[model samples]
Target: MIELFGDATGNSIRAAIALEESGLTFEPRKVALARGEHRAAQYLQLNPTGRVPTLVDSDGPGGERLVLTQSNAIMLYIAEKSGTLLPSSAVERARALEWLFFFVTDVIAPNAQAFILSRDSTAAHGDAVRRLKERAFALYEHVDRRLAERPFLAGRVFTLADIAGYTITTASESELRWEALPHVRGWLERVGARPAVERGRRLFRSDA
Candidate 1:
């Protein structure tokens, strides 16, 4: 059996969306961050870093059990296992990786740093946080420009790049200048409309 332990954070949602899109059957285990569940001994045994979005697969390659802690790694594993979420063509596959890392490193990393800084009360990091956020937001303009040239982030087909882009864009929706990014706004609408994406977004809801 495959099990995914996570909350509703962007990283977790990205993994859930990839699993859903790849048609993988896995149990969704919610890790309550507010309750400090992720740091519990049992959970820490599964993830030494005390982070959410850990995946455990009992029937991994050659029947060996697999444990994956990183969200992006889990997405790639799903894609590899299910033979989806990535294009078969070599060039398109490269494009998917390019755009996926573009969002993960360029966009998501800065915002994540800003979030950490905003939560730290021991120091005055307002200017640093603001600068990080500005840098992240400015990168979205490039995503908008790219979307204007193609239907999806990695060209004609939907791939992991779209999953990463969709989750981060959704997380930053209210803060973004949507009116100026028609292409990104439209892409968001399209990606959000997917059944898998919709279900993934709610996988860790209180009611769910």
Candidate 2:
């Protein structure tokens, strides 16, 4: 079994949702960031960066455990481990990876950094942050355009590309609104309606 260390609303939930959708059993080890658990000694030893969603894979050879810190790395790990969420063809797989890379580089990271900057009000700004937000929104618009034709990211099936994109993109809405992006919004509703995503959403809901 794998143990995932993360908070409730973070990408750990995304990993859990992916694992559930992958039909793999894993232990959910909650690390309460609000209580400063992620900065604690033990977790620091596990992840020097003190990040959440550290996946401790216990089934590796010689009893050696693998600790994956980044959420994208964890998603890719679980995706490859299950071998079902990714497309079968080489070209399709390459396209899936292409979208995955685009989401991380073009969409999630820039928007998140700018969102943090705008929220914090301390970060220096110039054409950089504006360009960051612009590029992020532009990539989102591109995603909306692609989703207008296909229900999923890679193609017809709900692959790991959608899983990766859905988690970060939806969360980015806290700073970047998707309502105006009708095509992306439509895709979000379609993917968000999945059973696993619903379960994951309930995990963050106060009413749940």
Candidate 3:
């Protein structure tokens, strides 16, 4: 089985959701970020950045254990390996990749910036932080419009794009009001109805 080292939110939940949706059994190894476990020397060897959600596959492409870092990358790997949650047609596949990129670049990027600025950065960064938060909302509005046309980001199939976007978006539910974005709210509910999605959502949030 694969070993997933992660905490409860952000990128960690994204990868866990993909693993569950793939129907692959993986061992979830909790890394207590509050205790600086992610900064430990032992963990740093696997991930130089000492980030949560590092995946260690005992058997990889050629029998060697694969050490993969990055949330979306891990999600994509799981989707491709399991042959599920990926669009079949070439056009749809291209669209799926496009949305995944949007999630990583537009959605996740601004949200991460806002988070760091709000929690760790000084008040001097307030202007930049506000800008990032605005950008995130704008990108979400774009996604809402897209969802109004199609059931899923890549059309009909539930692809990695949805997994990536949904995880990040919900991570900030306290800040984002889904009432205005009816399409996005509906999509979140629709995806949340999945067994795997709910399991993944609770993996890092057992306390909730």
Q: Which one wins on TM-score?
A: 1
- Give residue 157's error in model 2 in angstroms: 1.1
- Candidate 3 clashes between residue pairs 3 or more apart in a chain or in different chains: none
- The predicted structure with the larger lDDT, 2 or 3, is 3
Query: Per-residue alpha-carbon lDDT of model 2 for 99-133, expressed as tens digits?
Result: 88887777777867776676765656766778887
lDDT by residue for model 3 (138-162), tens: 7777888999989999999999999
Q: How accurate is candidate 2 locally (lDDT)?
A: 0.76
User: What residue runs in model 1 are displaced by over 4 Å at the alpha carbon?
Assistant: none
Give the Cα lDDT of each candidate. Answer: 0.93, 0.76, 0.87
- Cα lDDT over the full model 1: 0.93
Residue 143 CA displacement from its true place in model 3, Å? 1.3
How far in Å is the alpha carbon of 4 misplaced in model 3?
0.6
Candidate 3 matches the true fold with a TM-score of: 0.94
- The ten-residue window of minimal lDDT in model 1 covers 199-208
Q: Comparing candidate 1 with candidate 2, which one achieves the higher lDDT?
A: 1
